[model samples]
Target: MINVRSREFAVPFLQRLIQVDTCNPPGNEHKLSVLLQDVLRETGIASSIKSVEQGRSNLEAVITGPGSRKLMFCGHLDTVSPWTTAAGRYPPHGAVIEGNRMYGRGTSDMKSGLAAMLLAAASLHQDGIRLAGDLIFLATAGEEVDSCGARLYADQSSLAVLDGIVIGEPTGSRVAVGHKGALWLRISLFGRSAHGSMPQLGLNAVEGMMEVISLLHRHALEWQEHDPVLGSSSLSVNKITGGVQTNVVPDHCTIDVDIRTVPPLQHGPLRREIEARLQEIQQLHPDYRYQVEQLLDRGVVYTDPAQRLITTALEIAARQGGAGDAILQVQGVPYYTDGSVLHDNGRLPVLIYGPGDHRLAHQPDEWVDIDDYLASIDFYRELAIRFLGTAEE
Candidate 1:
């Protein structure tokens, strides 16, 4: 088995993972999957890779212990678009150790999280030491896109028996309890088209679109009620496209809106309210016609801090010098992840914690701190021991 005790094994493992260009858009993660499989095999852990699409894969390695409770540790293998400049997103190619930091793309975002977990599984030194529970290490794909790989895993009947899930997202060493839900809406405005010369003879589709947009702007302002932790629900028009030519009155215009919802902000009601507002605007402009289509809908994820997993995390954090207090509070994030799908469908206790600065995510100079990555490893390892205990296995 790969030794987790020394920094030697982890350094090389992480460096190799970074070297593999698994940047998404075509996210070919099979290369990394194969490497992980090889590591698991050497460590005497049986593993497998599952995928919805070829090359776009998820890796799962199970450490069977002597307990009934099963816990899963998940991390994503894909990175965002590479840096525009030749400098590289993950930085100086493989792992570059300078002082206290190991610079790289997926370091903070998650490759480091995955590496640490892998090392933990490979390095547990107790010869007869068995865990109080089963540990499942899963490196899922498409977390940066549609969460397709996570959905696939959640749907597996085997996952139903698990006690809970711990998602290794970059939370700067804090235990993130919850995140907001998301919905993508596309609104199309329809109107009559005629020659620009005879402006009075044609209904202006652009005007209809402008009115709808204005109404939404006002409506969004009305939703500014903030939650102490989740902050506030938000709506923004991200895309708008319409007219064909300057001379012709456009027949159609379409605008895409992104909405983030928190608890107390139900999706169905939110949608109904939006439609009502659109109808009100249409009433003032008789010639305007519009339709709203939902491109994607994901429910919000909320868990009780009293759950065993959350409690264990808090206790462990405390033992690690008050690092656990962050686990007690819920926070809102602008983006969505597989956590949403898993929490909603699995009905299992879920928490997000990891290393890396979120500001660097998907950016050109994206990189994670070396210290944060190592800290997350220790945090999760302690969290596991607290819950499973040393005696059971």
Candidate 2:
């Protein structure tokens, strides 16, 4: 059994954690996971590290209270790539306190939220607070990449049994109940290779691929359906590669696409639709040869407005912040996160509320307001108290 500590002890520990650099892309997260295990142990929060991929790991800890109802707090331990700016990676350069602000990478994109969860668990455990349910803390890895951590955790038999989940992604104090989903596709086209000088001799795969892109652009008009919360689905042709030399009319071209979907739209049908559209184009231009394959698929997420978990979080935020109707419903986010994976597959009521500006997440001057970090911890702690009730020893 691990022994827990007070809030004061937890805070400095979190700061020291923020002091560690665990940036992804060759995400060196094991060392940090070990550090977290040490910190969590200090508060009697026993934890275990699980991994599907070597080096990338997820950490889980639990504080048993006095109830059958279970409440889970989850945040990613792996951070996005650091800024290519002056701050650099080592020492995380500017993690200084300029009066009220705390400047550093992962500080906002959210080491702050991660810190809050740790402190909350320690504080609640040390106080011997009684609860309505067991409290689970999950710090996952590879969230900034594919949702490998969330997917692995959710697939666990134990995680599937949880009653509810709260994902600490920066929502700036509002109770965010939903997020859009993402599908990554790669479209490849084939054509006869010909010398650049003889333009018409060989088929131009680049043009054939562009034709498909044009069709996709036209198809976007038909796909522009919207929902009350997640708005319209979006398509972005982010990357295209073909042709080896400036002079040659390349025989192959491939395009990478990103598709964002709202809740009502599932991936199976959407994928079929895309394939159908491509097939239609193929029929129209029999000479064209192409194939479409999924690179990544993530489902959309939205809790019913009346869900008990969401309502509880809103009420807690409202009472503590004096903002009654503090439910935040948002549309498409440019990128994807594990929140959607947890909500869509785990089928657990999930919300993302934390501290920091989304824009500064990976920026050079990335930082979080110290007050915001502390306040978010307070809010989450109150939420734990409410959901877990008063911990009964």
Candidate 3:
């Protein structure tokens, strides 16, 4: 059993993490990674910091054991931007505690989970517990935006050694077996600009883009494939911009599309379909010109419900009087996680289990129950022990 002081260590640690703002647009996650590294060092654990970019990095600490099997505890350091409004009502990085919940921007979406995993690893080291396999703690940058840290780590590290992974994404303490894939695209239309009065002289890019939007809307409605566990594959045009002035015929227009997909709907094929449609439009209108930029491409994550990692977690949850049957009922989240990039194409069994309600993620007044946060520490520690087993075993 982990020491009772583990709870005491986790709350303040989480509070400090929330206090440090690592918002995504300018994800200064290296700041939080340094803090985490120092905390691990104090517990006599050696960790390495890998730079992702200027002021962005990923942190990895490993507890080496005799066996080759490995288990990784992963969480992202970056969070969504805090609410622009309601700053006075709920300070973004305040880490304010009201009764059982700790209110902050990253508290639920999930700095608390990151803190819990870190402390859990530290507690194992502090208690001098040696496992039969390596236990890894990975804190990544840019999960809320690009997943650059995870991609860098995946490209550089030897992932074949890992047998399983636990992603501390807020699941409200329930275990999630998978999540939807993401395919974000930015489509830009270009044409000749001219005065609005002589619209015939210029090819209107905004008008062309409107046609593209209509095509996309029709496709979204027509293509309806559903995954029983992950729900439906869907598309939405989240953002669009064009035109300098109302009087001028716009020369450029761009639309950002957010596409969430499930099984059987691969990103490559879907992307090519959009490109093929653009070609058709060009064929119809000789002057039509466009460019499609893939902003992000993350594969879907799906692990078998029968995987040892998940079964063991469910067993532990039941034994600990956790979510019980709710935790046992396997499901997948709609939002993508670092697991999407790190899962090695569903080869690795990644269990998404952590404190905080999934609904609270990215919402204003985000919070994680203090009790849930503390409980997750024990859950992580116990799962590591049971899955890896002690050296004596």
Candidate 4:
């Protein structure tokens, strides 16, 4: 394995990673996975790549020692398309560094985190550092969309023995302990199509959707489940499609609703209530009918703030990120992460920490500050020494 002892490797590693277009619509993460496998091999870190689909792949490399519990470092490889951005319009894959920032799609949304994790593993091995437990490095595909890559790796029995998981998602390099879950639903409302010129001959599907949209708001208030860390649970109409032509009253309308949920809000009950509300709306409008379908439903997930892993990360980041004696604070984000899948399904304590700004995740000019990325390496190195160090027992 090629040992990556310095932070300088992060810039080049991330640049190469960004240059690979693993855009989610056609998620060709297998190419990036193959490339990382080759790069990690220089450090003698052998990896196994598993295909989630023909084109999607997840990779894992294990640095082992004495303990039974494992510490897993995970990052997803897929990213949203940035082809429309001005820079991306010319070359979406070029990793351009100007001053302190490196601009490219997925630079912040997590190629930087993946590079950090890979380098941390390689550096630890090169330093002859051995923990009592195993240090598992994972880079998964399809995180920007379906999260299929995470779910695929989480299914392995090898992961079930994990002590904790570190997801190097962009969090401004601060530690984030928890995040809200998401529920996506689609409602199809049916109406009679008639001539647009006809005054009362047709039921407008778009008009029906206005009622459906209104009812969704009222229904959301019924649950009223709120989480202190993640704040209030809320739902919104994200996508609406109705009407075919200007001269015709559309016969059908569809609305996609996105719900950000906190704890104590059961997906089953929330879904049931939504269907019941749609039924109520249908009954109210005898001329129209509707069907509600679940597009995606995942409940909330949170790692305890007091977990040893959490404390260790905070301490390492504080000292290495120049906080000195000050304690680094942890906050919750409103977005979901691969950590949620690892925590919820694999039953592991997971921490969301890494370089770059979360606000820049999918933006056109997304980039990670070189200085921030460098500081993050020191933090990750320390975190490994402390958390993985316990394996010496």
Candidate 5:
């Protein structure tokens, strides 16, 4: 049996995981999934890997208990592409250790959290602890670009038995009760092409898109609703492109909009509102033809602070000692996780807690503190044992 709690076992495991390059444009997560499966097999745990795409996959390993209740520990296996310029000091997959931090592409953004959860489950099995409920470890793919693996699993799997979910996202070892939703949209406007000099001959799509942009800016500002934990909703037009060249009057214009939503804001209604705005534009300019495509939609995920899952986690953290009183408080992250999909429309109580600084996610030289990484394994292990309870209890 491996001493999963020891730094020798935990740190090297994370380093090996980070060494697997699962960057999201290609998102070759199958490699990491295979590695995890081998580790689980060595630990005497059975695991299965499912392919989400040609190169991406998800891994699942469960430790069966005596009862029907189930708890899941979920984390993503993909990371954003590393900086290609000289700005990056460490090799993205080197998993280099300096002092107390492990530097790599996915180290802080989450390979550490995934490693901690896997090791925690291994530790429980090694110690011969039997709980009243099942413990599940899930590693997903494509969270950085789109939650393809999570969405696939949520759509195909039966979530009826799950009592709670813990998302191992980078939360600096603090407990996060929820996170904002993401609504990504691609709006394209089409018009007739004409010579640049004779602009009057063509219906200018770029000019029409400018009007749409103004409307979106005003519409975003009109939202006043706010949640105490999640704060206010936000909208940003992150990317826009139009025209083939300076000489041609381009017939097409496209803009990508990212909207982060909190509670009391349903994505369906928001999408309808935008469509209505487009209709109003069409009413004014009959030639203003446009199409709106939903690129991605992830619902807001919030579990009540009073939920047993959360309270128990807080109690365990308080006992473990680290962030002090602040760790006990309920908080929310701006970024969405697999929980957004796995929450089953808020049916499952989800807890977002993990090692490393979220601020470092996606940044160059991303690293996770070694101490926090090890402590997270302890936290997850203890939380599982306490929340699931022993068969005797």
Candidate 6:
């Protein structure tokens, strides 16, 4: 097995990334982009930062060569809100290392992967390792919210020619070929307001919404579409709001349902099914009307298993981690990422591989095993070597 302990700069770079506090809701990725841009500058690599929204920016750096084949590395800069662990052992921004683990907000959710990509690419640039294709590094903003940075990049015509892309999402050193998408919908229920004392006089919107929720669950269970690797899709009512006062019957209710969908499933049919279910609820209650709105519909993304990127990642994982540690396999997680944007819009193939456990994402005192972190530095470094051949090789 290859020893990565000597890669002294990777952990410190990740520590600096975690300390920047690019917490979403007000994701100030522009600040971090400036810092990253400075690092690229010191490597003598040209880069550009484009603003996605106020205080949010996307950084793109290209290491161009004489070849037309292009490969890109992507990592999200925004992170979820800070949290305290159940044991109350560490602060979110502490970036503390105990034994072989580092705990902090965004530490696992993905500053570490971002750091690995940045450092690997920077090292390549500093060493002047020429390749057969252009090497593009993209640090995206608003990945935790809307993937605005990815959408921005997808709009550019220049990137349509990319041969492959690797998203540095926390994958625990595994290579993920695909993941489920999210169809977040908000449904509104309406009813006649009446005094709570005389409930029979008016319909209750909350009760109507409850019925709709039940119907949603029933349909979700009956839906036969399931991915072999991703398993069956799922629906859950994550949020519900209604009722202004206890004395008066509520006239309105709003509930948000999150549906995790597998790729190859058309989102149109699901949306239509939801509408039909809502219509059924409305028809049963003549006095009540229902409304539905799509809050978000991020599509599922999958790179074909036959793609060179997948084969190469598996090969690299095997070579770097040896037989026991590198358990690289084709798998899917129940989450949406900027890869959805690239796959759906730009028609690009994206592979997800990195350190850190996905279970720790958004958790209090989130942490990554230092060994995994160091292992990923080797992963990214070797991946670059395999994708973009070195001069001596």
**Candidate 3 RMSD to the correct structure:** 2.0
Two-way lDDT contest, 3 vs 5, winner: 5
Question: What TM-score fits each model?
Answer: 0.87, 0.89, 0.95, 0.94, 0.96, 0.94
Candidate 4 per-residue lDDT over residues 65-176, each given as its tens digit: 7877678888998999875754453356788888888888888888888888888888877777787788888898888777898888767645667889888888888888
Write one digit per residue (lDDT tens) for candidate 6, span 13-90.
677788898999789999899989987787688899998888989999988877778888999999998874564589
lDDT score for candidate 2 against the true structure: 0.76
lDDT minimum window of 10 residues, candidate 3? 1-10
What local lDDT does model 4 show for residue 259?
95
Model 2 bad stretches (over 4 Å): 1-15, 86-94, 324-335, 344-346
Name the candidate, 3 or 6, with the larger TM-score value. Answer: 3
lDDT of 3 at 233: 92
Number of colliding residue pairs in each model? 3, 12, 0, 9, 0, 0
Query: What lDDT score goes with residue 359 in model 4?
Result: 93
Best by lDDT: 5
Q: Write the per-residue lDDT of candidate 3 for residues 1-393, one digit (tens) a residue.
A: 335346566778889999999999899999999999988888899999999999999999999989878999999999998887645467989999989889999998889888888888888889989988999999999999989999999999878889999999998888789999899999999998999999999889988898999898788776667998888999999999999898899989999999999988999988998898889988998787889999999898998989899999889888766554676677888889999888887789999988998898888889999998998999999999999998888
Give the clash total for candidate 5. 0
lDDT per residue as tens, model 2, 1-393: 233233355445556767777788766677678898987786667899997577878888887766788888888887776666556543453466666777777887778888887777777777667666888888888788777788898788465567788877776766776777888899998888888999889889998887889988887778776877666888889999999898998999999998888856778988899899888887887777888989998777777758788778777766766753433333233345677767546478777778887777777767777777877777778888877687443
- Residue 82 of model 4 has an lDDT of 74
| lDDT for model 6 | 0.82
Task: Quote model 2's TM-score.
Answer: 0.89
Superposed on all Cα atoms, the candidates' RMSDs to the truth, in angstroms, are 3.1, 3.2, 2.0, 2.2, 1.6, 2.7
Could you tell me which 10 consecutive residues in candidate 6 have the lowest summed lDDT?
1-10
